[model samples]
Target chain A: MPDTIAPRSADAATPPTPRMSGVGRVLVAVYGILALAATGRTAVQIIERYDEAPVAFTLSGLSALVYIVATISLVAPGRVWYRVAWIAISFELIGVLVIGTITLVAPDLLGAGTGNPFGRTSTVWTLFGAGYLFIPLVLPILGLWWLAKHRPAPETTGASATSTAVTPGASGAAA
Target chain B: MIAWFAGVQIAVAVVGALLAIILGLLGRKPSDLTMGPLILVELLLIVQVVISIVAPLVGNEPSGSLLEYWVYLISAALLPIAGGFWALIERSRWSTVVIGVVCLAVAIMVYRMTQIWFVQGL
Candidate 1:
C-alpha cells in the first residue's frame, strides 16, 4: 500500500492545501454572508441616495468590494490566493478601524448630522459596526489569524516536500 | 405584517440559535438536532416572504424604504440556506456554531424587518 501510494503522491506533486476545511469553512461562511450584506448595503446606499452622502456611500462601496475580494481569496486554492487573502483581510481591518473611529468621533464628516436628508450615513464599519453587532470589526481579525495558521508549506523546503510526500500515503491508507 | 406572526418567527429563531449553540458547546457534529431548527427558521422565512408580498397588496404597506425591507428580508432568508450548506459539507462542531450564529442573525434581521414594516418610513 505504501509503495503504491508513494508513487501516486510523487505523480500528483503537492496537492493544493485545503483552506476551506473545518474552522476555515466557518470563516468562509461568515465572510460570504458579510460580502452579501455589504454588497446589498452599498447597492441601496449608492443607487437610492448617492447624492445625500457621496463620501459615505463611496466608502460603503469600497467596503463592499473589499468584502467580496476577501471572501473569494479565502476560498480559492494556491499560494497566490493565500497572499491575496492576506492583503484583502488586512485592508479590511484597517478600513474597519479607521472608519469605525471616524464614525464614533466625528460622524458629521460622514454626513451623520441630524439635519442631513437621510438620517445618519451608515456603513458596515460604521461605529465599529455597531449596527451589525461589531462582526465587521471582529471578522478581519479572525481572518488574519486563520490565514496565519494556514500558511502554505514552502515549496522549496526539503522538509515540507517530505511531509507532503507522506500525506498521500496516510490518506490513502485511511481511505 | 401580522404582529403575532413576526413575534413567532423571532421566537423560533432565537430558540433555534440557543439550541445550536448548546449543541456546539457540547462538541456535537452536524445532526438533525442541529439542523432541524435552522430548517424551521427557513420555513418561517418563506412564510415571511409570502406575507411581505401579500400584506402590501392587502393595504398593509411598509413604512420604511421598500427596497431596504425587501433586501433585508431576502438576505435573512438566504442566511440559513448558506449555513445549512456549510454544515452539510463540513460536519463539525464549529459548523454547528455557524448555524447558531446564522439563526441569531436571522432573528435580528426579522426584528428589523418588523420595525421597518411598522415604524420607520423613508
Candidate 2:
C-alpha cells in the first residue's frame, strides 16, 4: 500500500511549509541576530576574562550554542530539522526562564555581583534578558508557537489527499 | 567613536525604523520606500566601520576595552546587511517590520558602542 502511492505523494508532502518564508523569515532574522550577538559576546567573555566568571561565561556559551542551533534548525528543510527546531527552542525557553530567575534571585552565583570586573551582568538570559530588552525571554515562546502552528504534514496514511487539499490553501493565503 | 557621528547614526536608524514600521503597518511589501532608509542605515554603518578603523589612529582612542568596543561595532554593522538581505528574500510586510526591528536594534547597539568608547573606561 505504501509503495504504490509513494512516488506521487512524496514530492507533494515533502515539505508542507517552507520555514523560512513570510513571518518565519522575520523570526529567523531575529534568531540570527541573537546567535551572532551571543556568540560574539561569549567568545569575548570566555577568551579575555574566563577566570573572572567561569560559570556565567559557560552559561553564556550554552545560550549561544542554543541560539545558533535554533537558527540553523529553523532554516533547514525536512522533518528531522523541524524536530531539532522544537528541541532547540524548548531548551532556549527553559534556559531563559531558569537563568533569568537565577540571576534575579542570586546574582552572585553567576558572578554578577560587585566582584565582577564588568560591573554588570553579561549572560544572554541575565535578569530575564533585560540586557537585550527581554527578547531572549520572548523569542523562545514565539519560536514554540511558530513550530506548533507550522507543523509538517504527516507522511503516512492519507498523506497525499490531505497534502493536496492543504497545499493550495496555504499557497493561496501566502499569495 | 566620534560623538556626533554616533548621534547621527542613531538618529538615522531611529528614523529608518519608524519609516519601516509605518510601511509595515500599512501592509506594504518591501519596496523602495521601506528599504531606502535601511540602505542608508547600512551605508552609515559602513562609514562607521571605516571611522572605527581611523578614529583611534588619529589619537581618539576608546577609554573602554578595545575588544568590547570593536565587537559591538562589528556586530552592529552586520545587522543592517542581514536585515536587508532578509527583506530582499522575503519581500513581505513582516520583512519590512524585521528591517524596522533591525534598525531599532542597531540604534541601541550604536548607543552601547558610544558608551563603551566614551564612558566605560578600563
Best by TM-score: 2
- Lowest summed lDDT across 10 adjacent residues in model 2 chain A is found at A112-121
Worst 10 residues of 2 chain B by lDDT: B113-122
Model 2 vs. true fold: TM: 0.84
Name the lDDT of candidate 1: 0.82
Give lDDT tens digits, candidate 2, residues B1-122.
88999999999999999999788868888889878888898899899889999999999999877787788888988888888887887778998989998999899888878877988766
lDDT of 2 at A119: 45
| Candidates' C-alpha lDDT | 0.82, 0.82
Candidate 1 chain A, poorest ten consecutive residues by summed lDDT: A112-121
Error of 1 at B122 (Å): 7.4
**Cα lDDT of model 1 by residue, B1-122, tens digit:** 88899999999999999998888878899799889999999999999899989998989888877788888899999999989997898778989989988998899888878877887664
Q: In candidate 2, what are the lDDT values of residues A44-158, reduced to their tens digit?
A: 8787888877888898899999999999999987677899999999999999898888877777887745123234347888877887888999999999988876655444557
